[model samples]
Target: MRVALFTTCLADTLYPNTLRATVRLLERLGCEVAFPEEQTCCGQMHYNTGYREHARSLARRHNEVFHGYQAVIAPSGSCVGMVSELYPGLAGTPAPTYELTEFLVDVLEVTDVGAYFPHRVTYHPTCHSLRMLGVGTRPHQLLAAVRGLDLIPLPESESCCGFGGTFALKNADTSTAMLADKMRQVLGTGAEVVSAGDNSCLMHIGGGLSRLHSGVRPVHLAEILASTEEDPWLPETR
Candidate 1:
């Protein structure tokens, strides 16, 4: 199957490592993956910010670039959710798209990932993805299958990380308040790293951990799944 990688603007510029990890993981799974350069932002940022026209143009561009691929997989729940659910609403058009884990478990049907990380980890599901995409427990299926990885379920796995695109800017105070609770939930788990598909949320959560001098770090799901015990950095037991 020909799969296209929909690396969003944030993942493309702010968190390039996540996109690279995605490419590495998919290639190892024996699927042919291609990067479509024309694809940029899924217009989620604009759409979520009340800019319908700009979002429409972005949605159109995204669909035009992604149409024929067997599946378009992205490393972000936010962007994938935008393309799959929100884009259709904005542009009155829909196309096949998969958040990385969804594609891995549903399409690829293998979760061993051929990579191992000995870290005790937790997953944070961004709001749009947890509800809009209705991908309940499927992402966890892949996380649980990784060899040597102890996947601890978060207490409120469905809570938002509070990075609602421009919601951060418009209501910074509210955003931080929400983030505080999310960070607390993550810390409560005592996991070394918190993993999630959307870097925007991880970016917010990671900043909180840094400000508090907490030991926990926020990592993208792609990064964790692409790692292996060969690094020797992984804790021997966790």
Candidate 2:
């Protein structure tokens, strides 16, 4: 299948390896993945911040850039949810967009993509993926099949990590409080790494973990899913 990788702005700017891992994972699954250099922000930051016209303009650009692909796949659930859920309410019609796990599990119908990562990994379901997109169980289902990987249940898995994009910046106090609770729970689980679909959320959680010097780090779900025994991804470096 022909697919376009919609590497979100955060991934492109901060986590390039996550995007690379996504491409590698799709190629491993026999998908012809293409990266449209024209693709930019999905206008999520503008939209969520009440800049309707600005968001609409970027949304139009997003539609144009991802126009012809059979499937436009994104590593971020927030960006995909922004395109899939919010774009329709904007001006132009958006191309059908799928979050990476959804495209892998629902469209490709494959969970075990030959991934191998030996670590006590816990998944944090981002708000857009869990609440907005309703991508329940697909992520866990994929992680369950990874060889030598110990997937643990995150306590109160549905609770938000308080990284609501602009929400974090606007309400710093509330955001930090919510992050404190999330960090406590993450530490309680004794997980070596916390995995989530959205880098925005991971960035928030990861920063807090770093402050505490907890050694627990945040990893994108794509990075973990792309790993294999032969060419293993060292979680410490990732």
Best by lDDT: 2
Superposition error at 5 for model 1 (Å): 0.7
lDDT tens readout by residue for model 1, 43-156: 877877788899899888888888788888888777788888777677766557898878887778876787677889999987877877777777687788777788888988
lDDT of 2 by residue, 1-238 (tens): 9899998999999899899999999999999999888877888888877888999999989998989889999899999999998888896668779999999999999989999999999999999999999999999999999998999899998999998999998999999999999999999999999999999999999999999999998999999999998888865454
TM-scores for candidates 1 onward, in order: 0.92, 0.97
Off by over 4 Å in 1: 92-94, 230-238
Q: Candidate 1, TM-score vs. the true structure?
A: 0.92
**Native-to-model Cα distance after best TM-score fit, residue 83 in candidate 1, in Å:** 1.0
**Candidate 1 global Cα RMSD:** 3.3
Q: In candidate 2, where is summed lDDT lowest over 10 consecutive residues?
A: 229-238
